[model samples]
Target chain A: MDEVKIIEIKKSVFADNVKDADALRAELKEKKVFLLNLMSSPGSGKTTTLIQLINRIKDKTRISVMEADIDSDVDAVKIKESTGVSSIQLHTGGMCHLDAEMTRQGLDNLDLEETDLVILENVGNLVCPAEFDTGATCNAMILSVPEGDDKPLKYPLMFTVCDLVIINKMDVVPYFDFDLERCKKYIHLRNPQAQIIPISAKTGFGLDHLADWLLKQLP
Target chain B: MHELGIVFYIIRDVKKVAEENRVERVSEVVMDIGEVSTVVPHLLTHCWRWAADKEELLKGSELKCNIIPAVTWCDDCKQEYETVKHGKTCPHCHSENTWLLRGNEVEIRELVVSG
Candidate 1:
């Protein structure tokens, strides 16, 4: 009989990212630097909200922001010009999201040793960005009122995995048909431990509260 | 969005594995992709064809995807249902207390090489 050879190799292609993310988290813990992976849809006021946050924390601690986009450094320029903080623009070529390996590379490019907090403004999309962990200490997402109350149902995975959910554009809640309570109910269904905060980047309604809550999460 | 970049990542992994296994060529690479993982299988293969041919080891190799169905477990009913169909609610119980039990995976399940 002819010799038979069969090798059974059961492995995951995306496994490296998960392991890498965990290692990165442990390293961040050792350095006492908090890394936040902030995600949201375009026009959800991610940049605006980040600017507000930078102002609130810059005086007390050293903060750096990484603006990731398919192409363009417009947000990076805005961050540096407005907040005067060390900001870097990460161009993902044509990718919609930043995976763990990509996030690690971005961190290496930034000044990790000198900075206290590193917030990665992930590519502005709710679907792909939330699917992968960016090796952050925590992950957050912004759901604008105009995005509707049914979003939690549509994007259950995003809501389920996020540590914090910020409901932005709350100032226009009256004009829009968004039901905040109903939305929160749905979010809790997916993630019972998730913290939902209502805020408006335009009016600075809940920036302080968000800042206070953020500072508490840092190591 | 960058299925091409994803293909590059796959090639890199396959090369490393082949080097470790002391294999001259790879016949196929099988991937288990969940229905809701945000990875378009067709696009992945499309990019795979373009990049895989460039490498000597993967010149004529094949890339196959095994689709994994998405299921959500309803906490209220203590039952599981199709996630893509029923979404967030349990179909049998109509309860919103549900979470995804499966799907959303992009894993390399198997690698085929001749002895």
Candidate 2:
């Protein structure tokens, strides 16, 4: 039997994922747990920033982390050992971004109901993670001093999608030729409402302001 | 890249459709990608070539992408404008307070196969 046929159907595979993500967002909102999806390139101090944040806010707010990586539980193990925070490592296998399904699985694996604040550390890619919504209340993108200032313009999608832009590795800014003003201007051009905060996770500088911001967002 | 993952989704979805219709193989897949969706058509097609080559049902299948223009509505001027090229401040009133009308979409529109 020789047959040729065409089927026209407009369907979004991501539609189901988006629905699930919205449900997760509503659930988190009801629990008064503020969820933040942190995205950045590798070695941009995302883990370190989380470490500092966990250290500071551990006593204040019940903290938990869902670390997404392409293929590593090492970061999760380090986070667990250093901060003693309950963290679950999500291995995406080959997937670059963590979709809502993976996040739902992570939430199921970890006891999210007991936690007040949940931080989803997305895979070390700027582009894909920004497009995938993992049911977070807010999205935060970290740009370190060594990455330079032109990042916001070069990777406008990631910068524009984020609610907060954390300028990390401030301690090394003196050694690197990173222009702070240019970074701010670029980010503002992409998204005027983006909140900018500069900090050194190693030196524990500028963390208080971040902590305050997080606290204000909670409930 | 994420395009590889999206290609997987497309193939998987097409396979499901083929199975339901008792089709043996897929010949072509058409997708509508929004201009602002961040998924590059060239990258998607590249991934599609690699991914479809591995599957028997999708071998030598053609992947076609339609570019949908990014549009937004300016509340100040009550007019729609293109936002694909960036720096798209409203031409009428020069207001940046614009809501996106269309452009953030990525979906499978059609599938062709042999039954």
Candidate 3:
């Protein structure tokens, strides 16, 4: 009979990923590529907002889009057609979120030398994505008017991780009971430093501000 | 599910440790799961059974989860309280300036292996 030995090893599950994310950030800084991780729920207008923003800033900056999903190339194709930017689709192979390693693999597939800004449209999830850092320069999320103001409270980690929160679908805000002030308050409660931008990807309202915010982030 | 993703991470780490320690088989993997870590223990164990069996070193191993009670500290009151019950706001001070002191942990505590 073999004797049992208890091996002591106390380590966080996310520790390795955090190190990988930091290393990736350092590499991106050396390459002068700004990677933005954008997250939101399904149908939160992430694609529409990206298309509008890309078209506005594409000429000045060499932008690329990496669309990550459980299974789909719809977003990648749409971004290429609408914005005419270099776009790639990364299949997570049924995974709920992309980690730093996965993001690095996707980056390897891109023409990094030609790209200035790489926008990673993370999987349409607020939970798992918030847990894993995707090695992005900045983290952003969209909360449409229909999702209500209490989303920040419901998903505190998501709000806490994001540097920018875009309140999309503002053109239809009046139709819904979405109180902009209350929404801002809830977002601030979770992350006081989070910058909230109200925009309508449909009407192009306040998108300039969103574009400016992104451009300012880049070197 | 996210639990399955976490299971994969656990497997990777365990395999690395087994290789380093020259252990043939792991008997049990212990985890310290915080109450507010957002990981469902039952779901994690369920995922573990399915994924762990696929690996040779982790086959037939047991996963034991130690639930760590969540505690939050209020800067205003200089006191601590249960996080699950209070959640972000301090009950004693009624202050929203409180932050989690401990409880959001998903850690591999120790491994029981055959010597």
> Which candidate ranks first by DockQ, i.e. highest?
3
Query: How high is the DockQ of candidate 3?
Result: 0.86
Tens-digit per-residue lDDT, B15-66, candidate 1: 8887887777777888888898778999999889988999988888888999
RMSD of each: 2.7, 2.8, 0.9
Scored by TM-score, the top model is 3
Segments of candidate 3 deviating more than 4 angstroms: none
| lDDT winner, 1 or 3 | 3
Interface RMSD of candidate number 1: 3.7
lDDT of each: 0.85, 0.87, 0.94
Worst 10 residues of 2 chain B by lDDT: B83-92
Which wins on DockQ, candidate 1 or candidate 2? 2
Worst 10 residues of 3 chain A by lDDT: A210-219
lDDT: the better of candidates 2 and 3:
3
The clash numbers for all candidates, in the given order, read 1, 0, 0
How high is the lDDT of residue A185 in model 3? 92
Better of 2 and 3 by TM-score: 3
Cα lDDT of model 3 by residue, A62-152, tens digit:
9989999899899999999998898999999989999999999999999999989999999999899999998999999999999998899
